[model samples]
Target: MFESLKKKFSRTSEKLEEELIEEAEAEDNLQEESGSRFSFFSFGRKTDEKKEEEVVEEEENLLPEAEEIEEVPEAEEVEEIPEVEDEEIEEEPKEEKKSRFWHRNKDKDEPAEEAEDEEIEEEPKEEKKSRFWSRNKDKDEDEEDVSADGEAKGGIFSFVREKTIQEKHVEDILFELEMELLQGDVAMEVATEVVENVKENLVGKKIKRSNDITEYTYYALKDAVEEIISIPGKSMTEMIEEKKAQGEPLVVMFVGINGTGKTTTIGKLANYYLKKGYTPVIAASDTFRAGAIEQVTYHADNVGVKIIKHQKGSDPAAVAYDAVEHARAQGKELVLIDTAGRMQTNTNLMDEMKKIKRVSNPDLVIFVGDAITGNDATEQARKFNDAIDIDGVILTKADADSKGGASLSIGYVIQKPIMFLGVGQGYDDIMEYDPEWMLNQLFSEDEEIVENEA
Candidate 1:
């Protein structure tokens, strides 16, 4: 039934999710750009430092070779070569004599040479093993350092990290939703409250994934609506039972503006109670309006319930009192007082309605409103509640109301529960108001299934 309102809520959630995701993506892109720039500059600086170190090492190696060349003797020392030659000539004969002895022991020296070669190979093998072990240890240590650093710095996967919802992210979206609600015939106060509640629920929350944005938004909107509709009060059936236990009828007074289906609502209520096995007496107290008494009487007869009615121009308060007396005498469980439909500005009619309340001392005062009237119904309910404290609300023609502004705003405006919804023209068309049902209608994807289940 609430097609327009449902669409508004759905759009708001989607828009908010989109806005937040966009902002998160923008921030991540900025971070990536800044990170890339920093890495590029650092790499260039490290390359320059390595080149300078290599140049210094080349100059040091050339200095040592030049010093060794300068230390060698020149050709001017030729005379000293004669003494060196005589020493070489005398050592040659000694070398020839020893050569014969060396030739004989060469076979024995071959074993030693083989052993020396084996030792040389073994030394390289040990060195290679140590180098491999050292390289592996260094690699493992580097890996550990990288992991520790990743944990502390959010790592390369920082772009996918959870985003915390900020005020700026939702401020514009919530404002838009508030304006849309107002345009949809929602009361300004109700719209403002919904926005504030949603903002409070969403801000500072962490969204771990893209899907979490939608989930969070849905719950935030649902919770705000739930709070607005959940007015604390006893239901009519409970009141009836309470009074019934005390051997008295539960008196209920109905008030509303003109042509909002007040009489028909009363008739429907009469039939509803009659079917419930409760002996209900209807009070035709709407004597100001022409045919009001007759209309109520017709319903009373049709529903097979007793009706206490007066002639035209009779005191409505007196009629209500008579009906309550009748219910008490007959041991009826309910007294439904139907009052004249009057505008909130009609002082005379308002005073008269108040008199009916004083005389009847109703256990509950209900404001019946037309759901199609939207904000007008909400305003009327507020005025009536200010005039007389209404215990609850009943919205008529709810099935025909596509906007559903009144159903959403009336109870919240008056701080009263919407006890029932008048869905159709038949006597059994009314159903008790359920907040969960309203939520399902607004948020469920399968509206037809939800309606059927409801």
Candidate 2:
């Protein structure tokens, strides 16, 4: 029956999923671009380092080798060298000058050769060690930089990283959903509360896969609705049993505006309890409205239950009081009081309804609302509750209510449980309200698809 509301919720989930997935994809693309830029710079720097290393290695290779000193002549060559020197002695000044030059050259060559040998031994070793250390240090630094970059960009396995839902990702989508809910006849506060609850549940949640988005969205919506419909209180059946155990009838008064099937719902309840082995008496307490007494009497007669009713223009409160006394005297297990339908703004009728409540002192006051009225039903329930604290609700014409706004919001807005739903026109058409059933109706995949097709 809640086709419109169901579609709204389903569309909201889908929209949120699409928005989040799009955001995630965009982020992945941005990170990929960043990683590509980083890789490009890294490649360029490596190429420059390779070129510099090549130049250094080439320079090292072209360095001249240490010069070898000439070995001294053998003993025979040494004697010939002495004879040559004696011949050169004829030019004594020239000989002395040449000998001194040779001695000076020999003395300088020895230290230069030793220094050259030390340089050859230590310089290449030191240079190679320095180059090796510098290369290793640079390699380590590069590795660290790449590691940091990878982490910052979500690494090579970026797809495995979970996406955390953010407020920004869902804000606009939720706002739209709220507007749709309001348009669907959901009460303003109820719509706002649902949106806030969903946001609280979704924001900061982590999703590991694409399917997770759908799953999380579904549950978030489901939970919010569940909380909205789950009013903490005893069911009507429980109250009946409790009162029955105490050997007293359960007094339940039904109140609502006109044309909400209030009297029909009362007849339904009477038949319902009658079948359950409880004798229920109907009280025609709506003596103000024309034909109200006859209408209630018809239902009571049709259901074969005793009705304590008064003539039109009589006191509704006195009628209710007499009905309660009749139930007590007859030892009936249930009392269903039907009050005249009155607009909440009508002070005289509202006060008269309150007088009935005061005189009857019903164990449970039920608000009968037309599910088709949507937000109007909710507002009526609120005003009725303010006048005389209603204990529960009965949503009539629920089977025809496709929008389902009143059914979803009435209980939550008034802080009362919806005790029953009138699904059809038969005397047995009413069924006890079930929160789980409503949830399933909204979230079941097959049902959703079927409704969409219709």
Candidate 3:
């Protein structure tokens, strides 16, 4: 039932329904005054026998037996306002030739002056009718479809406004949003938070619109993401500077399950240091993936950073030893040792990753996780953090995940600052993380989340 209600929000349909209901109620009210005549049947009344027969047929079918129509004789000076006459009203303008009553004599077309007086007197009533109909043609604006203090849904079905929204429509919009989020495989909590916040922002305002709603939604999402990544954790540069200032070369290690892009991130990290005027030396410590050594070597050569490698199937610790000696001799500022992307599920591999850390003695141990794997990334972070101390997280392929739930929730789960992001598959795919900008984009729609929470 909840899901069913969610897909029914149609802005065009809302407007159309409001107009229709008002029209129906107005028609019913007018019919009450006219006695048994639908407003539509008011025009084209005729005294002709054929017309009388047709009216009788319609009256028989529609008129309720509980109410009987009785017509009192018209008073000489007082009578209900004559109904609008389609043909007669138009002919009434030419009152100078009053042949309205045909007596089969010349007196039929004789008096035009009296007819003119009657027409003049009826003019004001006609003007009043015209004004009333014109004014009532539009739906009532005072019905109060949506209000912040009111119920989600109210007196009217599918009611909403630029200021307030119907409860059903809110459900509809939020449900659709939730499905989209889940289909993108966002974390369940992430999806729930988005739906909850979106509803809070959407109600008491016109969503499915541009203006404030669109901007509000974007900002709301941006803010949530920003909050997630905006941990007051230290950065790679800060860590490196702290280490170097204390007369210690910063050693950083990367860890994750196989095929999680751990080694690629290591190359990128090495590339980052080389550009920072810090000659970074990399260790091909990942012996699992066949192309791991060559991958680091390729990026290492391309970045003008040398990598320490050994023959395939060689012990990873051996390469780490050579890499550390090389960095120490060159007086390098940072040592980024790429460890095997081994599954933490395998106890032996987890032990190896731990042993490698002891051998390398890295200052920062970052777990490179895939953003597309959703909560699995969180579990991987936890597992790696348990196996070996994880200091921070480096989320790769961030832009690839559309829902972006992983990027947002990972920081909270892991309790670490996301140092960098891999946006695309370029050599310069890595970029400095922007917590504030990301938060703003996500929570841009939420004034409360962006301003009040700040």
lDDT of 3 by residue, 1-454 (tens): 1111111212222332344345445544211121111111111112134668988999888866434433233453245545565567777667745554344355555578668888899986554344332322223321222122211112222112323344554575567666765665556676676567656654565432222332343344434444445688777888878877876778888888778777777777777777777878888888767887888888788777878899888988878878888877888878888887777799998888878888888888888999878778877887888777698888888876755656766776667777888877765788877776554333222222211111
Clashing pairs in 2: none
Q: Give all candidates' CA lDDT scores.
A: 0.77, 0.79, 0.61
Comparing 2 with 3 on lDDT, the higher-scoring candidate is 2
What's the C-alpha lDDT at position 345 in model 3? 90
In candidate 1 the C-alpha lDDT for residue 108 amounts to: 76
TM-score of each: 0.69, 0.70, 0.56
Q: What is the lDDT of residue 137 in candidate 1?
A: 41
lDDT of 1 by residue, 1-454 (tens): 8888777776675576557656766777312211111111122234346879999999998799777776665545654677878888899999898998898788677998879889888985564334422212444332332221121111111235667889998899899899989988889999999999999999999866444565577678878988888877777888888888888899999999989888888888988888888998899988888888888889888888888988899999999999999998889999999998899999989998888899899998999999999999999999999999888999999999988788889888888899999999999899888887886566553332222111
Model 1: CA > 4 A from native: 27-159, 447-454
**Residue 318 of model 1: what lDDT?**
95
Candidate whose TM-score is highest: 2
lDDT value for model 1: 0.77
Which candidate, 2 or 3, has the higher TM-score?
2
